[model samples]
Target: MSSGLPAGVDLTNTLLILGGVGLVTLLLRALPFAAMRYFRESALVAWLGIAMPAGVMTVLVMYTLVNSTENPGGIGAALIAVVATAALHLWRRSATMSILFGTVIYMLLVNLVF
Candidate 1:
């Protein structure tokens, strides 16, 4: 115990505190899914489930492209990734494949190509 301290913090207490924090974080993350399950039949919930992904993705794409101008890559990496994503999605009609290919292309360009 420190000077005048009632009880000193030790490994046990520290681990307990961290575990409580982790549990809280897990519950917080799961809250949205719990709500979704409870509101599955609500029209607003159904609309958001269908529309939120595209809306969020569009915002992310815009953010990345807008931020790419500050670097020396001439926006090539971002542009290539965008094109790859669009092309793959258009050709295969699969969001997962499009996003995967786009991410790979961006990483390759940033690490090796440009």
Candidate 2:
């Protein structure tokens, strides 16, 4: 079967492409930690350290809710999971607990009820 890749894009090129992507991703992930020492005392960095997690979580929740609408049947389960997650977070103030329970709830609902 044909791969449909452009001519000249063979295994070597694919490996190189993947390696480049992996290197870029690794660097991107490590860049923030690497720069943290330099920005340790900066006010902006301090504020971001406190704020970025909430901002990122908000973005993720919005993305999940928006995407859930695309699958009509699963919307209820998604909403329930989000609500349960938020409530758990508010109640227990544990990120790990909230996320784990929320995921388990979502999976169960999707698999069994939805």
Candidate 3:
């Protein structure tokens, strides 16, 4: 059977291009996992696994604090939420309670302030 592609688009060339792309995609994804296998027993990898997530969380929290004031009453609500979260954590040392309290406080503050 003849290739169904439009004129000038050779079937063999199209297959080669698709195969190259698939190989590159597979290598790109597998390279990182292969590198991780080498570092499976290393202290650096262990520390990085822990520290990277903590660093990401800290950056996200700071970003939210900084950007919360873009709309009306957002700043005050965020402030209240942060304070409430802190207070809950301080009192009970419970992350779940702190998050719950913080969310409620934030909602209340937003409704009242805006």
Candidate 4:
């Protein structure tokens, strides 16, 4: 009976590998919750919690700007989307709405306007 798997790739080995991966994934997922109590009051953790969002957003914007230059008219659309995203975020203070609207505007510009 052909199991449709590759040669020498038996079910037992596959099951073992999957089990090991599942165990590792569970350990990694639980590690953060386990260590949170120890780092709960740490100043560095608090600082990261506050600064990471802006730092990540800045990196994403820079990456977008850099990549947009590759397309014929992507830079202008990217800039307009970025401005609209910033304005929306500033005015509404909702990250979800700002990001969603920014993505919609960028898609529209790239597909239809640009």
Candidate 5:
């Protein structure tokens, strides 16, 4: 009988490696929360928290526009999504709503229309 192993690798060894990786990932993810509980946020951190979202959104829009410019439909779809996102954000002042609407429009365009 064959060992309980993959085609080329031992299953037990692979599972041990996977378990170690999973544990390390879990610990790393928890580290930020643990540290936050112990330390107060600095002014720089607070400012970044407030400003980074808008900055990141702007970068993402620019990236999408630049990357999709090769195809006319892609450019048009991206522009429509960007405008919709901006309008939603302006009207409601909610980033969540803006991003959600924009993402939905973009996905629909790419999948069905464009």
Candidate 6:
């Protein structure tokens, strides 16, 4: 057992610090909901509600595209899928068909070419 932690370190003394940090995190996460109750008609809240989801989606898409090219054949397969998706979307104006077609094309390309 350790009598006391090294300099600048103490698990026993850090419990309260950790708890305070956790509490702050919880409060920050809950702040948007709390603000909604008090300022339901605030333009800032309304704008954030709309923009946040769009921003999240943009980030997710960028992350996916960035992480998808680890393998040698990934770029070609992704290109085929994107082209198929775009074609389906343009020709039929159907998001479901576009996604389905893209997935199928991607799988087929990966299996056959790579």
Query: What is the C-alpha lDDT profile of model 5 across 1-114, one tens digit per residue?
Result: 687666889777888999999999999999998888555658877888889998998899889999887754678899998998888888999888889999999888877898
Could you tell me how far off, in angstroms, the CA of residue 86 lies in candidate 6 after the best superposition? Answer: 0.7
Write candidate 3's Cα lDDT for 1-114 as tens digits. Answer: 677799889999999999999999999999999898789999988999879855864675577689887855677777777877888888998867776788777777777766
- C-alpha lDDT of residue 71 in model 3: 52
Off by over 4 Å in 4: 1-4
- lDDT per residue (tens digit) for residues 1-114 in model 4: 878889989988898999999999999999999999999999999999999988988898898899998964579999999999999999999988998999898888888899
Q: Which segments of model 3 are wrong by more than 4 Å?
A: 1-8, 71-73, 76-114
Q: Estimate each model's TM-score.
A: 0.77, 0.66, 0.54, 0.85, 0.82, 0.45
lDDT of 1 at 100: 83
Per-residue lDDT of 4-80 in model 1, one digit per residue for the tens?
Answer: 42466576777799999999999999999888777878998889988998998899889879988875454989998
List ranges where model 1 is wrong by over 4 Å: 1-8
What are the Cα lDDT values of the candidates?
A: 0.84, 0.87, 0.80, 0.92, 0.87, 0.75
The candidate 1 region of ten consecutive residues with least summed lDDT is 1-10
Give the C-alpha lDDT of model 6: 0.75
lDDT of 1 at 27: 100
Write the candidate numbers in order of decreasing TM-score. 4, 5, 1, 2, 3, 6
Alpha-carbon shift of residue 52 in model 6 (angstroms): 11
Over the stretch 1-114, how does candidate 6's per-residue lDDT look in tens digits? 675768778886688899999999999999988877878888988899889865864574466457669844577777767777778888998766776787788778777777
- Residue 109 CA error for candidate 5 (Å)? 1.9
Q: Please provide the root mean square deviation of candidate 6 (C-alpha atoms, Å).
A: 6.0
Which digits, one per residue and each the tens of the lDDT, describe model 2 over residues 1-114? 457878777877888999999999999999999998999899998899899988988898888788887764467988999999999999999988998999899888878887
Better of 2 and 4 by TM-score: 4
Q: Between prediction 3 and prediction 5, which has the larger TM-score?
A: 5
